[model samples]
Target: MTARVLLLGGTGDALAIARTLGPQHVYSLAGLGRVPADLACVVRVGGFGGAEGLARFLADEAVSLVFDATHPYAARISANAARACLAAQVPYWALRRAPWRAQAGDDWRMVSGWAGVVEAIAPFARPLFTLGREPLEHLNEVPEQQHWTVRCLEAHPGHARARIIDARGPFTAEGERALFTESRIDVVVSKNSGGAATEAKLAVARGMGLPVVMMQRPPLPDAQREFTSAQEVIGALDDYIKRSSNA
Candidate 1:
């Protein structure tokens, strides 16, 4: 029997990999989005409890390999995937996009994590937050005097000082420019989720000479192999299957 593959899904990279792998693989989403993307593979939504639950699921399903193409900032899920794959004795790989770097004319204040973001934006008012729904709670740490305009994939019950814009990405610089103008946004606060889908805002901020508080990506669990592109991951997965067959 052919080995079963499991893809920890959600990001554009995950969908691209699933499409390339066809319908034979299993794709799992965390169900955080209002509408999950349709994939060609077998789709599983919601979490598998935690690390223990994921290991049990992998055993029950006889999953031979796991591909983690989750969001860059999804530290907990990535950690769980690493632990579960190890416990289940399955081969695993992480597909991460290249991170964005500071460019000429970019006014970037690089910070390590969410706490750094809070501190970096302390004096700035009219902030545009693109850090997603999970970190919206942390906005409570910001002083009430600063008004925030948050843009995310889903609607979140944010602080009274925050105005939420529910939208998806593949955003363009022109559109982001309009948003920044309309919202009177003076600063942009975002995580370093590198990819073209949501990167236009950074360029727009830079063009407008707006200050950007960039939060660095969290550390990923050390995997045996890591890739930066969908094509590379596809090739690696094919090689992995070939090796499994020979074994």
Candidate 2:
């Protein structure tokens, strides 16, 4: 029997790896954002319930290897992938992009959780949040002294003191600067989701001399093999496919 691969993906890097997969491989998503229609591999949407369900799927589908190309902050799925792969006796590989580091003149305030974020931003009158939809949940709790500008994948009608900007990135530095200027953003709140796509905001914040409240990344389970780049993972997967075919 041919060795088939299972790819757990949601991030842009995951999509890059998924594009390289063939008919025997499967790309699984958690049913958020846009699903790609154009791929040689099968696309599976929704959750596998948890580790037990995922292990069952791996066995039922005869998946020989599992590649996790999820977002840096996606600790739960990453943990689940590790557990499921172990249970199914399959090799697990992961692609984690390097996180962005603070530079000179960058006023980065590292925070652990939502409470820490709230405390850090308390002094600022106008705060811009780029931490996905987490802020949306607390729209009702907006401080009387502050106005919030939230940017996420989906647009929502914000409350009196908050406005939502629905956007996708590789945001340009110039555009980010314009946004900060127009919104009069005193502070920026974000997660250390390291990638060029959203790194423009950090540069703009640095140039404007605005403080940034950064959320710490969660710890993830270790994979059998870990890659820093998608190209490296793709190369390794290709080598495995070739060797399996020859065997």
Lowest summed lDDT across 10 adjacent residues in model 1 is found at: 32-41
TM-score for each model: 0.90, 0.97
In the predicted model 1, the residue pairs found to clash are none
Q: What is the C-alpha lDDT profile of model 1 across 175-223, one tens digit per residue?
A: 9999999989998988898988999998999889999998888999987
- Which candidate's TM-score is highest? 2
Question: Superposing all C-alpha atoms, what RMSD in Å does each candidate have to the true structure?
Answer: 2.2, 1.1
Candidate 2, residue 131: Cα displacement in angstroms equals: 1.1
Clash totals for all candidate models:
0, 0
Instruction: Give the Cα lDDT of each candidate.
Output: 0.86, 0.93
